[model samples]
Target chain A: DVKVTQSSRYLVKRTGEKVFLECVQDMDHENMFWYRQDPGLGLRLIYFSYDVKMKEKGDIPEGYSVSREKKERFSLILESASTNQTSMYLCASGVGQGIVLTKNIQYFGAGTRLSVL
Target chain B: AQRVTQPEKLLSVFKGAPVELKCNYSYSGSPELFWYVQYSRQRLQLLLRHISRESIKGFTADLNKGETSFHLKKPFAQEEDSAMYYCALKDRGGKLIFGQGTELSVKP
Candidate 1:
């Protein structure tokens, strides 16, 4: 079984504060992703990392950055958290060679619900 | 650009009734489609994929290229089957573009 762990289940931050959401996977997957879930909007990708130090922007990457200094860990950074940023964040990891997207099977963490006040 | 569309945001059915959740996509090339489910307090997991052509948890979906739809169906709606279902499309780069998702509620 694959295990994807998010560092927090519930988080709270003030406006204009910096926030970090951490994720770790035990499956040694090569691809990691961060997504935000909102009502009626589904899961929107924030950022993704294919390899260490390699990152790509997803559909909703504004005001957010990601770090992948190691294979097992991926971190999402909110530069200046705002009330609008309050939402459920999810992290997923997939085992793929990074060449073909269809071959990748992603496993997701439990998710972190963040509240920005 | 690849896109996924799940028209229904919510669906309700009585137990032992048939249920269907509609999903459509707009992709220029051949696309890979997937269905994912998230139970209460559980992480999102893959329910099934078009390539595999398998039924999972009594739920099955068929890809219709003509209509560009992949609708999930089940003969009987079980209370345990109630969950948030998402339809996703795999882009050329392996990134998944997801639909807005549909919440299924099976009334006993």
Candidate 2:
């Protein structure tokens, strides 16, 4: 089975504080993604990494950045956290090229609910 | 641009009653569709994919290109089946666009 682990389950940060959310996958997948879940909006992609040092912005990448220094780890960074950034963040990993049907199935980690006060 | 839409924000059904969750999409190229479920206190996971054309946990979804829809259905709703269901669309590049999820509640 594939395992995706997020470093934190819940976090609280004051405004303008730098926040980091870490994720690690054991499956050696080439793709990792960060998403924020909000009521009625579903899950919106924040950033994704296809390979080490490769990153792409999704629909809502503002106020956030990502790092993929290694294959197994992906980190989401908030330059200066704001109250609007408070939400449940999810990390997912998938194998092979994302275009393929079977390979595109993503395994998600238990989300980190971040509270930016 | 590719998009997925799940119109219903919340759905309630009695146990043993049939249930259906509607999903629609808009994409120009060949699109891959998937249904994902998030159980209470659990991480989100893939429930089923349209390409497999298989039923999982007694639930099935058929992709209709003509109608641009992939609606999930089950003969009977169980308490255990209650969860948040998301409809997702995979673009050619492998980026998935997910719709606003539907919260299903199976009442006893």
Candidate 3:
């Protein structure tokens, strides 16, 4: 089975604080992704990394940055946390990405629910 | 731009009844469609994919290229099937765009 693990299940952070959400995958996937899940918004991609030290912006990358210093790890950073940033954050990884938008399959972590006050 | 759309935010049904969760997408190139399910306190997992063309847990989805849709259907809903379902579109970049999601509620 593919195992994607997150650092936290629930977190509380004050506004303007720097926040880090960590994720690790045991599947040796080449692609890692970060997403925020809102009630009606579903899962919106924030950032993704195809290889170590490589990153790309997703549909919603504002107020967020990502790091992939190691093969098994991908981290999502909030430079300055805000109330609007409070949500359930998800982490995912996959092997070689699809040739087009429809070919890839991303396996996900358990999720980290962060609350920014 | 490539996009995935789930018209329903919530779907409720009694156990043993038929159920369908709709998903539609817009993409120029060949797309791979998938259904991911997240049960309470569980990580999101792949339920089914169009390319695989298999039914899981009694649920099946047919990808209609002409209609640009892949709607998941089950002959009978189960209580354990109640969860959040997301439809995703993987773009040429190999990244995924997810739909708004549909929450399935099955009551006895």
Candidate 4:
């Protein structure tokens, strides 16, 4: 079974504080993604990394950055946490290939619910 | 631009009733569709993918390129089937665009 593990289940941070959400996948996937899951708004991609030391901005990448120094782990960083940033963060990993079959099928972490107070 | 849209926000039904969660997409190129489910207190997981053409937990979805839709269907929903469902589309860039999602509530 593919396992994607998030570092935190729930977190509380004050405004303007820097917050880090970590994720690790055991499947040796080459693609890792960070997304925020909000009610009504659904899941919006924040950032994604297709390879170690490489990253790409997703649809909603403002105020957020990502790091993938290692292939097995990806980290999402909020430079300045705000009230609007309080949401459930999800991490996903998938095979990085040119094809669309299993390459796009992602396995997700349990998610980290962060609250910016 | 590739986009995925789920028309329903919530669908409530009694146990053993039929269920259909509608999903639509817009993309110029070939789109790869997938269904992901999140159960209560559990992580989100892949339910099925269009290319696989398989049924999972009694639910099935057919990709209709002509209609630009991939609606998920189940003959009879069980109480355990209640959860949040999301439809996603994989664009040529290898990125995924997700739908708004539908919350399935199957009551006894």
Candidate 5:
């Protein structure tokens, strides 16, 4: 079974603080995604990395950025955390470029609930 | 326009009652749809996908191309089934666009 691990489960930070949320996958999948889960709005993509040092902006990526220095780890960075950024953040990884059907199957991590106060 | 739409914000039912969660999408070509569920304090996970054509935990969803809908159905609801359900569509770019979600609450 694939395992995706997020560094933190709950975090609290003051406004304008820099926050980092880390995610690591054991399966060495080529694709990694970051999303913020909100009530009534569901999961909105924030950023995704298909390879080391390569990143793509998702639907909502203005205040957030991501890092993929290594194949197994992806990190989400908030340049300046705001109260509105408080939400559950999820990390997922999927098989890369082999079988189209399996590539869409993403294994997820326990979300990090960040509270920007 | 939203790529995926799950009209209901919440659905409540009693145990043993049937349940249906509606999902619709707008796309021009072939579409790949999936249902995902997140239980309380648990990570979100995939429930089933359209191509699989297999029932999961007594839940089944049929993709209707004519209607552009893939609704999840379960013959009987259980307390363990209560969760936030999301319908997602795999776009041409390979990214998954998810619906707003439907919170299913099965009462005892």
Candidate 6:
């Protein structure tokens, strides 16, 4: 089984403070993604990385940025936290290509619930 | 517009009763549909995909291109089967769009 771990299960930060969310996957998957889930809106992608040092913006990338320094690790950075940024952040990793992909099913972390005050 | 719509926000059924979660999509191109489940205190996981044409956990979903719908159904509901179910669509592009999700509750 693929194991995905998040740095924190819960986090609280003051507004205007920078925040860092870390994720690590043991399966050495090439594709990693960061998504924020909100009530009624479901899960929206923030950023995704196909390879080390390569990042692509997803639907909602206005307040977020991502870094992939290593193959097994992906990091999501909020330039400055705000109350509106409070949501459940999830990290997922996928191995190969498109939808029918055998390894494309992303293995998700337990998710980090961030509360910005 | 390319989007996924899960009509029912919440669905409740008794144990051993049949249950179905409706999902519809509006996409002009080839569509790939999948059902994902997130149980309480657990991470979101894949339940089944239309491409595989397989049933998972005794649940089956059939993608009807003519109607542009992929609804999940189970003959008998189990307490453990209750979870948040999401219908996702993957266009020809690699990106994915998910529905609002349906909260299923199985009562004993």
Report, for every candidate in turn, its global Cα lDDT versus the true structure.
Answer: 0.93, 0.94, 0.91, 0.92, 0.94, 0.90
lDDT digits (tens) for residues A27-62 of candidate 1: 888899999999899999999988898899999999
Worst 10 residues of 3 chain A by lDDT: A96-105
Better of 2 and 3 by DockQ: 2
Name the docking class for model 4: medium
Question: Candidate 3 — which residues are off by over 4 angstroms?
Answer: A97-103
In model 4, state the lDDT of residue B25: 97
How well docked is model 3, in DockQ terms?
A: 0.69
lDDT of 5 by residue, A33-103 (tens): 99999999999999998889999999999999999999999999999999999999999999877323254
Q: What is the per-residue lDDT of model 2 for residues B26-105, given as tens digits with 9 covering 90 to 100?
A: 99978889999999999999999999999999999998999999999999999999999999998867788899999999
B1-108 per-residue lDDT for model 3 (tens digits): 788999999999999999999999999978888999999878898899898999999999998999999999999999999999999887766677899999999999
lDDT of 4 by residue, A1-117 (tens): 999999999999999999999999999998899999999888999999888998889899999999999999999999999999999999999998632325578889999999999
DockQ-based CAPRI category assigned to the predicted complex of candidate 6? medium
Which candidate gets the maximum TM-score versus the true structure?
1
- Those runs of model 4 whose alpha carbons end farther than 4 Å from true positions after fitting are A98-102
Residue range with the least summed lDDT across 10 consecutive positions in model 5 chain B: B1-10
On lDDT, who's better, 1 or 3? Answer: 1
Candidate 1's error at B5, in angstroms? Answer: 0.6
Worst lDDT run of 10 residues, candidate 5 chain A, spans A95-104
Task: Write the residue-wise lDDT of candidate 3 on A4-87 in tens digits.
Answer: 999999999999999999999998888888999999999998998888998889889999999999989999999999999999
Global CA lDDT computed for model 6: 0.90
Stretch of 10 with least lDDT, candidate 2 chain B: B88-97
DockQ of each: 0.78, 0.72, 0.69, 0.66, 0.66, 0.56
Candidate 5, residue B72: Cα displacement in angstroms equals 0.1
| Interface RMSD (Cα, Å) for model 3 | 2.3
Error of 2 at A24 (Å): 0.6
